[model samples]
Target: MEKFFHFVSQTGFSNIEVSSLVMLVIGLFLLYLGIAKKYEPLLLVPIGFGILLVNFPLSPLMVQPENGQPGGLLYYLYMGIELGIYPPLIFMGVGALTDFSPLISNPKTLLLGAAAQIGIFGTFLSMLMLGFTDLEAASIGIIGGADGPTAIYLSSQMAPHLLGAVSVAAYSYMALVPIIQPPIMRLLTTKDERRIVMEELRETTRRERILFPVIGILVTGLFLPESLPLLGMLMLGNLFRECGVVDRLSKAAQNELNNIVVIFLGLTVGAKCTASHFLTFETILILVFGLVAFAIGTATGVLMGKVMCKATGGKVNPLIGAAGVSAVPMSARVCQAVGQKENPSNFLLMFAMGPNVGGVIGSAIAAGIFLAVL
Candidate 1:
């Protein structure tokens, strides 16, 4: 009876706490959302599983193993995040996959991307007002960029302790782009502004495609050397795609390599949500502020779009400005859906891509700027 009692007590059920139970439930909810709702399954699924694994009592998957036991698999996988490796690799893959022709053809839209970064800085200031330290505020602010890897990268550098909250907030908002950006977009833009159609993008010359990455690197590097690590990898990936000579490298970067890295990155990030770290008042605040940041980013982008619309004599659709949040194709797609509702014949997807890709550049630049200034 004594041995039986001891063994049973050793199990997770005996060791569980209210916080761990809550985290477990949250992890399950994430799994359901990923599996059934199809909410970013590639990311959410792995992350949800990681969260589940780490929450179990004495699970070998969490960090700093107790009692001198070896750190678990997750602890090692987390090193990629801790060492700041996965985000850059993720950026490289993004660059390989992204089609920047729209941005190249419509260069002015870059301003929309830049305008959208107001969310990052705005959130930074807001967090500071709320009494977060500079590093924590800076880490939280990057979530506004709506770029998960950038958020993770900045947090890892500035505030490693806040990684779980910031990462979850960044990715959650990114997945909810469809739900969050639309209402704000509609509320801010006129029906006519949403309905406007633009001219087709001019065919980008091979020379322009080839020169863009190189020039982008030089210009950005000169301005913000601190950003070179993330920006350099991103531009290099794009160069592989645009060079027309590295089909194998481009294919690997965008496909196989990307897939493998995402699994590691997602799982490791999720594991960071150990109940002790994630279930705090500050974590709640981070979540709330993350939403505010994204909303501000969208509003600012659309307002900039409105300005551009008037300046260009109605060539620009204010809706496309919302794509400046750097959520990649997702934000751009939201622009398309909202625009089509206003004008069924208006195909804004391609046009939206201009600011969409530009937002990626904008977010990285913002991250770099934060790294430099803070």
Candidate 2:
């Protein structure tokens, strides 16, 4: 009986707390959203599983080493995040997979991308007014960029304590791009604006494609050396894709390297959401502030599209402006979907990609500014 009691006491049921239980449910909810709803599954699946693994009562998964005891597996993998390694590598993979032709074809849309970043600065001020320290606000502010890796990297730098909330908020908003952006795109634009069809992108020459990344790195590196870690990797990846000489390297960056880093990044980020860390009043505030930041970014992107539409004599589809968030192809697709709903002939995907990639670069620059100034 004594042995039986001791054995039972070692189980999770015996050690559970209210906070752990709450975290467990939250983890399960994330899982459902990933697996069933098919939303950002590659990211959410690992992250959700990590949350479940770490939240178990008396779990050793995230425990630090003590005495002769070895630390948990995730404790070491999490160093990638702590040391600021994974996000930049993720950026490299992003570059490897991304084509810069759209952005290069429509350099003017770069302004739309820059315009969207106002949300980050706007949110920064709001968080400060709400009593967050400058660093905490900075961490939360990047969530407006809707770039998960950038948000994670910046949070790890500025306020490591807020990483989980900031990451979850950023990725969740990224996934919600389709849902949140369409209404704003419609509300801000006229039916004619939504129906505006863009000119087909001119064919980018092989030399131009190759030179784009090279020039991109030089310009951005000169302007914001602090951003090189992220942007440098991104440009390197894009160079691999465009150079056409390193197919093997490009494939590796796009697939193997990206997949592995995402798994580690997602899982480790989720592990950071231990009940005590994630359930605080501050976490709640971060989520709320993060949402507002995203909304502002989407709004500003659309508004900028309108401005450009006016400037370009209706050549620009105002909806493409909404793609200025760094959610990548997702935001671009949402713009296409919203625009086509009004006019089936409208094909905004290629056009939206211009601002989409620009948002990626713009967000990285914003992070650099924060890192440099702060």
Candidate 3:
């Protein structure tokens, strides 16, 4: 009986054990959000599972080997993340999947995308005031751009310790865009402004389609050398799609390679969510600031859209301006859904895509600027 009691005491109820269980519940909640709510499920599900795996009592998935060398799954995943390989690879997939015709048809929306990045700078200042060092604060601030890969890339370069927090914050807020953005958007714009209609997008020529990636590459390479890895990979993927000679490669990059990398990236990001690192006051602060950053970006984009609406004689739907945060089609879809709520005949999807894609590029540019200045 004494031996049994000793065994129970030895095997049960400790802080790491309790924290691990708590973290497992958190992981399950994240999984529920992904599976049931479909909140960024592709990445979030894997991330949630990884969190569970790493936090399981005595789990070996993320721990160093007995030989005092690191050879775990998370260790390997961290290799790509640490060297900044995953984000560029992900960018390739994004570029291959993106259609740039909307931006080509309505070039003015690029300005709205640019305006949305004000949140990045704004959040950076706020973070600095909150006591983070310049580089760390800058990394946290870029989460406001609502671009996960860009946030990961910049955090990997500038403040690696903060990577997990910043990436999770960026993605979480992105998933919450439907919740966080609509209220700010509604508060800022009137009912009539929400009902504003824009002209349909004109068809872009094949020549323009072919020229865009090439020009984008050259201009980005010349002006922002720091963005080469991201912009270069993105343009390469775009060229593969537009060049008309590499359908197989483009498809593989978009589908297969993207899937594999996402799994690895998601798990690796979750591994960083170990309780000791993630369940901190700073983590809460990071999440709060990330939401703030996203809200500011959304507001700034809509305000810019309102300005353009007046200038364009109400041809621009200010709601589309809120799509300027770079979650690709997700932000654009939110804009469309909200616009349709105002008027059934409203069609803002294509117009929203301009700023949507531009937001992607704009976030990458903001990441580059953070890398350059800080």
Highest-scoring model, TM-score: 2
Backbone collisions counted per model: 0, 0, 0
Residue by residue across 1-374, what tens digits does model 2's lDDT show? 99999999999999999999999999999999999998889998898999999999988999999998999999999999999999999999999999889888779999999999999999999999989999999999999999999999999999999999999889888878888888888888999889888889998888998999899899988989989999999999999999999999999999999999999999999999999899999998998989899999999999999999999898999898888987987999999899889999878898999999999999999999999999
Please give, for residues 1-374, the per-residue lDDT of candidate 1 as tens digits.
99999999999989988998899998898889889988778888998888999999878776576787887898988999999999999989999999888999889999999999999999999999999999999899889999999999999999999999999899889989999999999999888788898888899999999899999999988989988878898999999999999999999999999999999999998999999899999999999999999999999999999999999999999999999998987999999999999889989999999888889889988989888987
Query: With candidate 2 superimposed using the best TM-score fit, by how many Å does residue 80's alpha carbon deviate from the native?
Result: 0.5
Instruction: Give the runs in model 1 whose Cα sits over 4 Å from its true position.
Output: 65-69
What tens digits encode model 3's per-residue C-alpha lDDT throughout 1-374? 99887766655253257778878888898899899999999888988888888886666677766777767878777789999999999999999999989999899999889888889999999989989999999898899889999999998889888888888888888888888888988998999999988887999998899899999999998999899899889888988898889999999999999999999999888888888878888889898988888899999999999999999998998998898988877899999889999999998888999999889899999888878877
| Predicted structure 2: lDDT | 0.93
Count backbone clashes in candidate 2.
0
Candidate 3 weakest ten by summed lDDT = 7-16
lDDT of 1 at 269: 89
Worst 10 residues of 1 by lDDT: 60-69
- The order by descending lDDT is 2, 1, 3
Residue 3 Cα positional deviation in candidate 3, in Å, after optimal superposition: 12
> Which pairs in model 2 have colliding backbones?
none
Task: Give stretches of model 2 more than 4 Å off.
Answer: none
- What TM-score does candidate 1 get on C-alpha atoms? 0.97
